[model samples]
Target: MTTFPQHSRNFLFTVLALVLPVLLGAATILAKTLTVSPTGKIRSVKEAVRLAQPYDTIWVNAGIYHENEITIDKPLAIIGRQQAVLDARFKKGIFSVMAENVLIAGLTLQNVEESFTKNYAAVRVRGGGHVTVRNNTILNSYYGVYLEQTDSCTVSHNLIRGNAKQESTSGNAIHLWRTDHINIVSNKVSGHRDGIYLETSSNSTITGNISQNNLRYGLHFMFSDNNSYQRNQFMRNGSGIAVMYSRNIIMTDNLFEENWGAAAYGILLKDITDGYIERNIFRQNTTGIYAEGSSRLLLKNNEFRNNGWAVRLLGSSEDLTFEQNNFIGNTFEISTSTNYSSHNTFRANYWSSYTGYDLDKDGTGDVPHKPVKLFSYLLEDIPTSVVLLRSLFIDLLELMEKVAPVLTPENVLDNEPSTRLNVWKS
Candidate 1:
């Protein structure tokens, strides 16, 4: 008797299968958009966050929201409209996002309270992967964006500034610890202890950033490897950039300028090996490039202009090559060890102070030019002797030392100097 209704039963089953999935898909999409507004139904950002599901987006309205310890435990997109301000003056830890696949964009985070025991930050990403933080302004915080044990994060197009007058209390603009696959691009960081500090980070790229007026080094790397820095500007910093105990690094096309101090340098390489530094510009720094305990490094096509000393190598550096570089308008071209000859080579470089003859009509100078002046070696040994830099007596002593080869290293000279200037008009 039931076999009479077989066609109706089959039609009902087909309708249920198709309609069920369509309704579920629509409900899931609707659950992903969570909006926060003062006049809307979702009153506060915290209330909107509680009602949000995974992969949801919480859009904050434009106003100052004083909150305490905002936590993001699930995958969500927190967006701010018209540069909404999130002031955490009374809060201990401002924003701690601990999940993966999170995106925080277009927000202004300011006034994150500092602590002695805890290292608080404006935005702390802990154990997150595939996170994106873009187009945000983070100011007046201990640390701008701190990444701890995270991977595959992209931080770009952000302005991070901190209080520089309070040196003991201020933190770095961007600090990365034990992270990998990080790409920090197109950011402006200033007025902190250090602009960017990377420790135990590897396989990262830092490009197109401006780091200026920091208390310490603009870019500091410690125990980091396989990292590349390109097209960044370091200006008015205490020290330009420092790389320590790192290997296989590539630093190219960067501008290190105005990092002038009593003990400062455009780039400081300490215990670094197998690195390439090319096409960089060092201008108006105390020492353009200073190396200590570095080995097997290649310095090529760089411009050292208007610096106190173009290059300074301590006795610990060995097997380094300084080739095809332009040393122009510097107080001293090279300063090296006084007693022993360095195992470094300086060939085919344009030295502005070279006055040797080119008798064979070739583009290279016929006679070798002693780059390390005796006066420079004296200044290195005795810092107070720098007062005699422009004296005629010091010039006469330098000329005599160049001809007789005394007091300074004998083999630390540029044998094949370029006849024409290696001007980088670009």
Candidate 2:
């Protein structure tokens, strides 16, 4: 309804001359502080916010504020002093931001009722830029922090926990829709449908976050491009992470472990292209990486340990390179739908099952290494053959398959296989 002039639109940080003695937390550092306390001139947080001007910092003291859908329609900094709690009584949302240059920090928000019709969230930002939500705790929320059409937002150092038992009735911890240039870092999320979800959101960075115990994927990205996921841990989630229909993705130094189920995978890449997945750890998952309809993948220096089917390449994969990696103690090293294809390359990787002799004193083995086993191919055709995994007859068949390459692909061999495991550097 109201818009500033062209010259004043970007002057959000211009200091005003409005003088007020605010509380001590961020008021000591803010331009102006509007104190909200039980015994102060402003008794309620809503009253303080209603009378506060732009660029003013509203400090809510350490107390419980029972508010339903407190909306911020102007540029302001609402910082809670000593982590004040805002209880929505399981009836509505706690905070909603519709303005740019808003900063919400140091608060405990709780209790947003689940509604099939309304996507009730603890904190919802609707079309804003430079919104910073940091160092807060959200509990029992339908959606902890929902950003829609926002840009340049930073959500950092927050803890979000939801009680979501079913996927159809639950929401993500942090959901971004059509947002850009956002940074999500150092957050802990648990017990949600999806811990962090991105849909059509691009140029974002997600780092140093721990997402676990979620009912769905720990981090789900669909149709999002140019995103970076680094230093994150997805443990015991329903299926770890999923990147679908995206390009130019960089995933590095993340840990995907203990995501065990018939349909679970450490990372699922479907229709993804031009991605770099390096230096990550995938352990104890049903499948370390399940790739289908993907191309131009660079997987280097990663570790896949003690998993079932370390990597599964479906029928439509091509142009993938696994270099200088370590595959240790996996039940099945590589499994493919069709005959193992030469479209992917595996060079200088260490496989624990490779019993070759480096007689030349060279670190690389003289003979080529084949990762696909006969039992894996047999299991693919008839899954009931898994019952004979440890049988001596199956061992003989696998040894015979390894002695000769009749059933496997002719060219899917690592010529320079490493005799030693590739060590990780930090």
In order of appearance, the predictions have TM-scores of: 0.91, 0.91
- Top lDDT: which candidate number? 2
Best by TM-score: 2
* True-structure Cα RMSD, model 1: 6.5
Per-model lDDT = 0.87, 0.89
In candidate 2, residue 337 scores what lDDT? 73
What would the per-residue lDDT of candidate 2 be over residues 321-389, giving only the tens digit for each residue?
A: 999999999999988775545489999999998888799877898988888887887777888988998
RMSD (Å) per prediction: 6.5, 5.7
Question: Judged by lDDT against the true structure, how good is candidate 2?
Answer: 0.89
lDDT of 1 by residue, 1-426 (tens): 446488888999899999999997886677678777667888766677678897889898888877657788888889999958888884665678899988889989998877767778888999978888898999888889988899999989999998766657778899999999999999999999889999999999999999999988899999999999999999998877888999999999999999999878899999999999998999999999999999999998899999999999888899899888989989998987655456998888988888888898787998887888888888878989888979999989877876687688877878999888665533
